[model samples]
Target: MKVQSSRDFKLQREVDYGTPEQNKAVKQIVADIKQEGDAALFRYTEKFDGAQVDSSNIRVTEEELKAAYNHVEDSFVAAIRAAADNIRAFHARQKRNSWMDLQPDGTILGQIIRPLQRVGVYVPGGKASYPSSVLMNVIPAQIAGVPEIVMVTPPATGGKEGIDPYILVAAAEAGVNEIYRVGGAQAVAALAFGTESIAPVDKICGPGNIYVALAKREVYGAVDIDSIAGPSEIVVLADDTAEPAYVAADLLSQAEHDEMASAILVTPSQRLADAVAAEVERQLRELPREAIARASVDNYGAIIVVESLEEGISVVNRLAPEHLEIVAQDPMALTGAVQNAGAIFLGPYSSEPVGDYFAGPNHIIPTNGTARFSSPVDVDDFIKKSSLIYYSKEALLRDGSTIIELARREGLEAHARAVEIRLENEAKGGVERGE
Candidate 1:
C-alpha cells in the first residue's frame, strides 16, 4: 500500500462495460433462449457449465433439497437458521400496506403497493458459492410477499456436476423451492422469457460475472433487474484513536474479494496513516487470496493523509464507497457528515463483514460510486406501487377547467378535450334535469 497526501491522490477504476464481442455474444444467447426456449437453454447449459441438463433434471427435486442437509454440518444449518431469522425480522419492519385517504369532497387518493408475482435470484458458482447472497436476495422478496422466488446458479461447482450443498441448504432455508441448474446469459434469458421447465419472473436480483451483468442489462426492459453491480469497495475513515491492525484488517477484507476490489483509508493523523500502511502490508501476506488482494492493493488501494477530520469527510463523500468504516474516537458523531455510503460501520468493532453476514442490513449494495444515487436491495425492491386516483363528480367539476388549461397549454388537444367533454356532459345533464 502506498501512503500519499490527500491533495495528490484521485480514485480511478475503469468501468467494465463488456467488450463488443462479449456484448454481441450475450445478445445472441438471450435471443436464442427467447426463441428456442428449453432447447437453447439446455444446449447452452452444456456448452458453458458442462452440465448435460434437460427438462427431466433441470429443476432440483425435494429429495435433493433434503439430501443437501446431510452434506452440510448441523452447525451450519443452525447458524443459517439464526441468520435467516434475523434477516426476516429486519425486513419485516420494512413491509408497507396499501393506504387510501378520503376527503370531505368525496375524493379518494392513495397508493396501492403489491409484491411482484415472481422473482429470480442468480447466485454465482463454478468456483465460488455465496450462501449469504442467497439469504440477502431471497429474504427481502419473501418479506415483500412475493408468491414465487426462484434461484438459478451455475450447474457446476469446482468442475463437478452438482450444485454446492451449502447453496442448496441456504435456498431451502430461505424458503425458495424452485432451484434451477443453469447459469450465464442463458439463465438470465430463461428467467426473463420463460422456458418449458422455468417460469418467467417479474424481476431478477443478485450478482454475477461480466457476462451475466451484460445479460441483465439486455433483458432489463422485459423484466426488472437489480443494479449491474461493480467490484466491491471499502473506505475506512479513521483517526489517531483508531487501531492500525483493525483498520488494516477491515480494508483487506474487501480487497481479498477480487483483483478489482478497492480498499482505502483517509485520516488526519500522519502517525496513524504510517502505522496502518505498514499493518496492511503485514496482513496482506497472510491472506489466502494473497495474489488477488495484492493486485487490488497495489493498483487501487491508497492511504491518504489529510489535514483535518472535516477534510477527510469531504473526501469520503466524493468517493461514495460501497462500504465505509469510521474508526474514530467518536464514530457516530461523524455519521451525519457522511452523505454517500452504501453501508456505514461505526467504531472498530462494527467491521464491514458484520454487515455482510450476520447483520440485518442487505449486503448487496450499490458499488462503483452508485451509492450516490441508488440503494441496497430491500423489501421495496420486490414491490411495485400504483397510484390510486378516485375523482368524485364534485372534485372533477372543480378541477376540470384548470386541467384543461394545463393540457391545452402543452398542445395536447385530446387531453384537454377529454376533460372538456365530461364537463359538457355534466352541464347538459344538469340543464335537462332542471337543476
Candidate 2:
C-alpha cells in the first residue's frame, strides 16, 4: 500500500472497463444470439467455455438438482437455510400491495402493483462458486411475487463439465428451479431475447466480468438490468481510535476480489495511517490470492492522511465506493455526511463481508460511482407499476374545462376534443332528461 497526503492522492483511478475489441465482440455475440437463438448459444458455449449444449442439456434436470444436495455437506445446507430465512424476512418487509384512493366525489386514483411474469438472474461461475449470490438475486424477486425466476450460470466451473454443486444447492434452497448452463454475454443475450429453449425475461440482475457488465449495458432497453457494475471497492474512514489490523484485513477482503478492486483508508491520524499501511503489507503475503491482491493494492489502493475527520468524509463521498466502513470513534454521527456509497458498515465489527454474505441487505450494490444515483437490487426491481385513474361524471365535468384548455394550448386538438365530446354528451343528456 502507498501513503500520501489528501492533497496528493487522486481519488479517481482510470480503468479500461472494456476495450473496443471486447465491446465489438460482445455486440456480435448478442446479435448472433438474437438472430440464431439456440444455435448461437451452442456455438458460443463451445467457443468460450469448451462445453457442449443442446436441447437435451440446455436446462438443469430435476435429477441433477436432487444430486446437488447429496454432494454438499450438512453444515453448508444449514448455513444457507439460515441465511435464506434472514434474507426472506428482510425482503418481505419491502413487499408492497396495490392500493387505491377512493375520493368522495366518485373518483378513484391509485396504482396497480404487479410482479413481472418472469425474470433472469445471471450468476458468474468461472472463478469460484458464489452460492451467496444465489440467495441475493433470487430472494428479492421471489418476495416480489415474480412467477418464474430463471437463472443462468456458466456451463462449467474450474474447467469441469457441469455447474458447481454448491451453486446448484444454493439455487434450490432459494427456490429457483429453472437453471440453464450458459454464461458470459451470450447468456445475457439469451435472457434479453428469447430462444427456442429459454423464454425472454422482463429484467436481468447480477454481477459478472466486464463482458457481462457491457452486455447488460447493451440490452438495457430490451430488458431491465440492475446496473452496469464496475470493480469492487471499499473506502474506510478511520480515526485514532480505529484498529489497524481490522482495517487492513477488511481492505484486503475486497482487494482479493479482483485486480481492479480498490481499497483505501482515509484517516486524520498519521499514526493510524502508518500502522494500517504496515499491517496491509504484512497480511498481503499470507493471502492465497496474493498476486491479485498485491496488484490491486499497488495500483488502486492507498492510505490518505487527512488534516481532519471531516475532510476524510469528503474524500469518501467523492470516491462513492461500493462498500464503506466507518471506523471512527463516533461512526454514526458521520452517517449523514456519507452521501454516496452502495453499502455502509459502521464500527470495526461491521466488516464488509458481513454484508456480502450473511447480512439481509442485497450484496448486488452499485459500483463505479453509480451509488450517487442507483441502488442495490430489491423487491421493487421485480415488480411494475401502472397508474389507475377513474373519473366519474361529476369529476370529469369539474375538471373538463381545465383539461381542454391545457390540451388545446399544446396544439393537440384530438386530446382537447376527447374531453370536449364527453362533456358535450353529458350536457345534452342532462338537458334531454331535464335533470
Candidate 3:
C-alpha cells in the first residue's frame, strides 16, 4: 500500500459482460422468454442458477412465510422489522396526491402524481441476501400506493421449498405480497416480459450482477428500469485530522463488494496519506475478504496527496463515487462543495454502511460517475406524473389563435383546422355572439 497522487493511479475496470455480443444474446433471451413464457423462464433458471424452479413452487406462500418466520431467531427478525418500520416511516412522508389549480380565467392545470400499477424488485442472492434491500425497494412503492410489489431472488441454498430466513422475514416485514424463486438475467426477463406463472411489471428496481444489469437494459422498452447500476465504489476525502484506521476501514468496505469495486482516498496531508495507507495494510490482513480487498486497493484503490482540502474536494467531485465520505475538520462545510456523489457521509461517525443498511434514505444509488447528474432511488423513481389541463370557453378563445398560429407555422394544417372548426361550431350554436 502506497500513497500517490490522482494522476499517478487510475484504475478503470468497466463491466466486460455487457458487450455488444453479450447484449445480442440477452436480447434473444428476452425475446424467447416473451414468446415461450414459463417454459423459457424455467429452463433459463435451471441453466443459469442451477435451481430446479417450476410452476408448482414459483411463488412463496403464507404457509412458507410463517414457517420461515419461526425458523429465524426472534431478536434478529425484530431488528429487521424495526428497520423496515423506519424505512416505511421515511418513505410515507414522500407520498404525493393529485392536485389541480383553478385560475380566475378558468384555466385549470395541475399534475396527477400516481404510483406504477405493478413493480418488480430484484434482490441479489449471492454471498449475502440483503433483506434490507427488500425494505428499501418495497417500502417506497407501498408508500406511493402501488397495488402489487413483486420480488425475485435466486433460490436460497436452504431448499426448493425454503429460502433464506432473513430474506423471507424481511420480505414479509417490507409488505411484499409476491416472491419468486428465480434469478440472473432470466429473472429480469421473466419480470419484464411476464411468464405463465410470474406476471409482468411496469417498472423494475434494485441491484444485481453485470448479467442482471444487461438483462434490464435488454428489456427496457417492454418495462421501465430504474437505472443501469454498476459495481460498488467509494471516495473518501480526508484532512490531517481524519483518523487513519477509520479511513482505511471505510475504503475497504466498498472494496470487499467485488474485485472491480473501487476504494479511493484523497487527502491534503502527505503524512495522513502515509498513515492511512499503512492502516489499510494493517487492517487488510485481518478482514474476512482481505484478498479481494487487497486486490481492489492494489489495482483500483488510491491515496492522492493533494495541495489543499479544496484540491482534495475537487478530486472527489471529479470521481463522482457511489459513496462519498468526508472526514475533515468540518465535514458539513465541504458538503456544499460536493457537487458529485450518490450519498455524502458527513463526519467520522457517518460511515458508508450507515447509509447502506439502516439509513432511511434509499440505498440504490447511482454509480460509475453517474451521480454528477443522477440521484439515489427514491419515491420519485417509482412514480409517474401526468399533466392535467381544463380549458374553459373563454380560456380556449383567448389562447386559440396562438395555438392555431403555431400549428400553421409548423405546417400542421389539420391541427389549425380542428381549432377553426371548434370555433365555428361555437358560433353556429350561438355560444359566441361576438363572432
Candidate 4:
C-alpha cells in the first residue's frame, strides 16, 4: 500500500454511484410488475430465486415460524431478543412529537406527526440469512409506532417457504407481523402495488443485491424508500497510538461485506500506516472471506499518508463513508468538523461491528457518498409529518387581510376565500372558534 505524498493522491471523482443500466432495468421491472401484478411477480420469483413460488403462498404462517424457533439455538434467540431491546431503546429517542405554534397576531402554524401506517423491510437472502438485519429494519418502524411492519426475503432452495426462522425470531422480537416468501424486484413490486397476497406498503427498506436496489429505484415515487444502498465502506482515522492489528481487523470487517466494499485508512504517521498495511496482509490470509476482503482492499482500499491530522479529517469529510471510525489522539475534537458520515464510531473500542449488531444505533445506513445529505434508517424515516392549522374566527379576522393578500398574490382565490369567510363571520360574532 503506497501513499501518494501530496493532495493529488485521490483519483478523480469518477465513482459511478448509480448507473443508467441499473436505472433502466429497475424502471422496466416496476412497469412489468405494475402491468401484470401477481403473474409478473411469480414469473420473476421463479426466474430469479430458483424456486417455485406463486401469489397463493407468499405469506409465512405460525407453524413455519414455530419450526424456525425449533431450528435456532436457545442462546442465539436470547441474544437476538436482547439486540432488539437495545435497538428499540435507541430508536425510541428518535421518535418525534407534533407541534403547534401560536402567535399574538392570531397566526397559527403547526405540524402533525403521524406514523407511515405500513412499511416493508427487504432482507436479501440469496446466499445466507442476515438475522441481525431483521432486527435492524423492523425495530425502528415499530418505535415510530407504524401500525404494520412487513418483511420479505428470498426462499431458500432447500424448501424454505419464507424467511429463515432465526430471521423470524429476530423479526418477532422487533415487532414485525407480516413475513413474505418473495424476493427481488418482484418483492419491491409487491410492496409498491398490492397483490392478492402481499399488502402494499408506504415504504420499503433494508439491504439487498443489485436487483433489489434497482427495484427500489424504479419504485421510488410509487412508495417511499429508505435509500438506494451501494457498496459498504469504512474509513479508519488512526494515529500512532492506535493498534495496527485493530485497524487491520476493522478494515477486513467492512471488506468482508462484499468485493466492492471499500476500506480506507488515513494517517499522519508513516510508521503506523506501514504497520497497518502489513497487519492487513497478515490477517487477510487467515480468514474464510479472505478472497473477498483481499480483492476489496487491493482495489478500492487506500492508505493515504497526509501531511497532518487535520488533512486526514478533511479527506474523511470528502469521502463521508458509511462507517467512520475515529481512532486518533483526540477523536472528539475533530468530530465537530465532521459534517458528513452515516455513523461515527468514536474511540478504538467502538468498532464497526458494535454498530452492526449490538449498538442501539441503526446499521441500515446511507451509502455511495450519500452520507453528505442522507442519514441512517431511523424512526423518522417511517413517520410522516403533516402541518396543521386551526384558527378561530376571531384569530382569522385578526390576520385575514394578510392571508387574503398572500393567497391572491399567488392566484389561489379559493385559498384566500377560505380564510376570509371565517373572518367575515367573525365580524358578526357568528362562530366562536375557541368555545
Candidate 5:
C-alpha cells in the first residue's frame, strides 16, 4: 500500500471504465438479444458461460429448486433463513400504501403507490456465487408487492451445469421461484425486452461485472434499471484512536472483491497512517485472493495523510466512496458532516462486511461517485407513484381563471382551452338549469 499526502494523491483509473472494444461488444450483444431473442440469448450463454441453454431447461424446474436444498448443509439454510428474516423485516418498513386526502372544497389530492407488475434481478454466477445478492434484490421487490420476480444467473456455477445450489436455495428462501439459468448482457436484454421464453420486466436491479453494467446502461429507456455501478470503493476516515489492524483488514475486505476495487485510508495522524500502511502489507499476504488484492492495493489503494480530521472528511466527500467507515474517538460526531457515502459504518466494530451480508441494508449500492445524487436499491425502486388530483366543480371554478391565464402566458392555447371548455360548460349549465 502507498502512503501519500492528501494534496498530492490523484486517482487515474476513473478515466477508462471499460475498454472501447468491450463496450462495442456489449452493444452488439444487447442489440442481438433484443432482435433475435431466445436464439441470441442461448448462443451468448453457450459462448461466454460454456453452458448449453435452451427453452426446455432455461428456467429452473421445481425439482431443481427442491433438490438445491440437498446440495447445501442445514447450517447454510439456517443462515440464509435468518438473513432473509432481517432483510425482509428491514424492507417491510419501507412498504407504502396509496393515500388520498379530501380537501374542504371537495377536491381530492393524493398520490397512489403501485408496485411493478414484474421485475428482474441479475445475479452473477461462475467462480463467484452471490446468494446474498439474491436476498438483497428479491426481498425489496417482494415487500413492494411485485407479483412476478424473475431471477437470472449464469448457467454454470464454477463451470459446471446448473447454477449454484446456495443461490437456488437463497432464491427459494426469499420466496422467488421464477429462476432462469442465464446471465450477462444477454440476460439483461431478455429481461428488458421479452423473449419467447422470458417475459419482460418493468425494472431490473442488482450488480454485475463490467459487461453486465454496460448492458444495464444500454437498456435504460426500454425498462427502468438500478444504476450504472462502477468498481467497489471504500474510504476509512480514521484518526489516531483508530485500530490499525481493523482498518487494514476492512480495507482488504473490499480490495479482494476485484482488481479494480479501491481502498483508501484518510487520517490526520501520520503515525496511524504508517501503522495502517504496514498492516495492509502484512495482511495482503494472508488473503486467498492475494494477487487480486495486491493489484488493487498497489494500483488504487492508498493511505492519505491529512493535516486535520476535517481535511480528511473533505477528501472523503470528494471521493464519495461506496462504503465509508468512521473509526475515531468520536465517530458519530462526524456522521452529519459526511455528505456522500453509499453506506457508513461508525466505530471499529461496524465493519463494511456487516452491511454487505448479515446486515438488513441492501449491499447493492451506488458507486463511482454516484452517491452524490443516486441512492441504494430500495422499495422505491420497485414501486412507482402516480400523482392524484381531483377537481370539484366549486374548486375548478374558483381556480379556473388563474389556470387559464397561466396556461395562456406560456402560449399553449390547447392547455388553456382544455380548462376553459370545462369552466364554460359549468357556467352555461348553471344558467340553463337554474342551479
Candidate 6:
C-alpha cells in the first residue's frame, strides 16, 4: 500500500454505467422476458448459467429445502439461527403503526403504512455463497409483514446443476420458501413481470454483478428496487494508539471482496501510518484471495498522513465510505463528527465484520459515496405509506379558496376546479349534510 499526504490523495472509482453493448443486451433481455415470459427466462438461464430450467423444476421443492440441512453442519445451523434472532430483534424496533389525528373540526388526517404484498431477493451463485445476505434482505421484510418473499439464484454452481446447499439452508432459516432456480437479467425481469412459474414482486433487493445492476435499473419503474450497489469499501480512521495489525487486517477484509473495492486509512501519526502500510503488505500475502486483494491495495487502497485528527475526519466525510472504523483512544468521541459513513464501528473490539454478520443492523448498505444521501435496507424499504385525508365540510370550506388560489397560480385549472366544484356544491346545499 502507498502512503501519501492528505492533500495529495483523492479516492476515485469510475462509475460503471455499463458499455453500450451490455446496456443494449440488458434492454433486449428485459424486453424479451416482458413479452415472452417463461420461454425467454429459461433460454437465458441456460445461456448464462448453463442450466436447463423449466416449469417442471423451476422452483426449489420442499425436499430440496430439507435435504439442504444434511449438507450443512449442526453448528452452522445454530450460528445462523442465532444471527437471525439478532437481526429480527433489531428490525422489530423499527416497525411502525398506522396513525390518525382527529381534530376538533372533525377532520381526519393520517398516514397508512402497509407492507408490499411480495418481494424478491436475488442471491448470487456460481462463485461463492453469501448466506449472510439472505438474512440481511429477508428479515427486515418479514418484520415489516411482507406476506410473500421469494428468492432467485443462478441454477448452476461450479458448472453443476444444483444450488449451493448453504444458500438453501440460509433461505429456509430466513423463512423464505419460494426459491427459484434462475438468474441474470431474465430473473430480474421475471420478478418485475409475472411468468408462468414465478409471480411478479413489488420490489427487488440484493447484490449482483454489472448485468444484474443494469437489469435492476431497467425494471425500476415497473417495480421498485434497491440501489445499484457498487463494490465494498472500508475506511479506517485511526490514531497513534491504534493497533497496526488490527487496522491492516480490517482494511484487507474489504480489499479481499473485489479488485474494485477500496480500503483507506487516514490518521495524524506518521509513525502509525508507516507501521500500517508495512502491516498491510505483510497481511496481503497471507489472504487466500491474494491476487484480488493485492490488486485492490495496489490500485485503490491508500494510507494518508494528515495534519491532525480533525483534518482526518474532514477527509472521511468527503470520501463517505461504506464502512468506517475509528480505532482511536477515544473512538466514541469522534462519532458525532462523522456525517457520511454507512456503518460506523468504534473502538478496537467493534470490527467491521461484527456488524456484517452477527450484529442487528442490516449489512446491505449504500456503497460508493451514496451514503451521503441514502440509507441501509430496513423495514422502511419493504413498506409503502399512503397519505390519508378525510376533509370534513367545515375544514374544506375554510381552506377551499386558499387551495384554489394556489392551484390556479400554478396554471392547473382542473386542480383548482376540483376544489371549486366542491365549494359551489356545498354553497347550494346540493351535497348531503353528513354524506
RMSD each, Å: 1.9, 2.0, 2.5, 3.1, 1.9, 1.7
Better of 1 and 5 by lDDT: 1
lDDT of 4 by residue, 1-435 (tens): 455554756633334435787767767777888888888788877887777777557777767776777777999988887888788889988889999899765668899999998899998885557889888888888878888888888876234554566777777766665788888888898899978778799999988887787788778888999887888899998889899999999999998888888898989889999999899999999989888888888877888888888888889888988999999778999899888899999998999999999988989888778899999988899889888877765676666899899999999999999988877776787766693
User: Residue-wise lDDT of candidate 5 within 1-435, one digit each (tens)?
Assistant: 889999899976662357899999999998998899999999999999888889999999999999999999999999999888888888889888999999999999999999999999999874468899999999999999999999998888635546889999999999999989999989999999989999999899887888888899889999999887877899999999998999999999999988889999999999999999899999989989999999999999999999999999999999988999999999999999999999999998999999998879988888888898888888988999999999999998999999999999999999999999988888888535555
| Tens-digit lDDT track of model 1 for 130-242 | 89999999999998999999999988752563889999999999999999989999999999999999999999999999999999999999999999999999999999999
Candidate 3 per-residue lDDT, tens place, 24-120, comes to 8788888889899999988988887777788999888888777788778999887887777777777778777889999999889999998899999
* Candidate 6 lDDT tens digits, 1-435: 899999899887967889999999999999999999999999999898778899999999999999989988999999999999999999999999999999999999999999999999999974457999999999999999999999999887424638888899999999999999998889999999989889999999999889999999999999999999999999999999999999999999999988999999999999999999999999988888999999999999999999988999999999999999999999889999999999999999999999999988999999989999999899999999999999999999999999999999999999999999999998998776774
Query: Against the true structure, candidate 3 has what lDDT?
Result: 0.85
State in Å the error of residue 40, model 2: 1.2
lDDT of 6 at 41: 97
* Steric clash pairs (candidate 5): none
- What does candidate 2 score in Cα RMSD to the true structure? 2.0
Residue 435 lDDT in candidate 3: 50
Off by over 4 Å in 2: 14-17, 430-435
The Cα local distance difference test for each model comes to 0.93, 0.91, 0.85, 0.83, 0.90, 0.93
Name model 1 segments beyond 4 Å from true: 158-161, 431-435
Using TM-score as the measure, name the better of candidate 3 and candidate 6: 6
Candidate 3 at residue 384, lDDT?
93
